[model samples]
Target: MNTIEEEVPLGRRRRRRYSVEFKAQVVAACQGPGVSLAAIALHHQLNANLLRRWVEQAEGNERFLVARSEVSVPSAATPAFVSLPLETRNARTGEIRVEVRRADQSITVSWPTSEAAQCAAWLREWLA
Candidate 1:
């Protein structure tokens, strides 16, 4: 006979340590095509917010590694966006604007709506 136990999120539970391999796997899965972070986290039995934090850490580490102690980096990571207090329901449709420069040309692209997952995926691919 097989018995299954349900997981319960306890209050102030003990800290769990994840291996580098496991973290890498989770990060990669979260960045995979058509894969949402929430879905990946759920599938791996992880907290979605924790996974997001890991992604931020991984991205920062990746940047440092790429620089290889040659290039200087800022002391603080700047915020990618700022909040606006003014609000208008009669405003134009919102779009996430993206600009990419390569070789001698620059291209700007905009995506309609606030589709964060799609934006993240596009940015990852474009930067890679």
Candidate 2:
């Protein structure tokens, strides 16, 4: 069954121990395109839940290893946050503007920027 039976000291209970290679093989099968995990588990004579846990552990370990390797590699081209100059406008003079055009009629509405919530509600009702 591709597993080793280990006898526990406490009782007559024996635990099944799967090799790393066998686990990797099963996990790879589960990751195949359009593959059913339950079907794979049945083929391997393993419980579906245990196979699922193996798959999760494999994926999590892969992610952790990848993250660790990335952190170890130092690249000059790696992106870093840089401050950029932004155009600043007076908030008191700012207006929430909306332009609506239908057929040949055009309407322009401007609301105070401070009442943005009310302007949004009004715009929603107007559009609806």
The most accurate candidate by TM-score is 2
Query: What lDDT tens digits, residue by residue, belong to model 1 across residues 1-128?
Result: 11113334778665677655566656766554556899878988889999999778878897523433343322333456788898643247677677788999999987766686798898899779
lDDT of 2 at 101: 90
Which pairs, if any, clash in model 1? none
Distance from true location, Cα of 16 in model 2, Å: 0.5
Model 2, stretches more than 4 Å misplaced?
5-11, 63-128
TM, every model: 0.39, 0.42
* Top candidate (lDDT): 2
Clashes of 1: 0
| TM-score, candidate number 1 | 0.39
Candidate 2 per-residue lDDT, tens place, 46-109, comes to: 9999999988887789753344343333222535689998754535578877788999999888
Q: Which sections of candidate 1 miss by over 4 Å?
A: 1-12, 63-128
lDDT of 1 at 35: 61
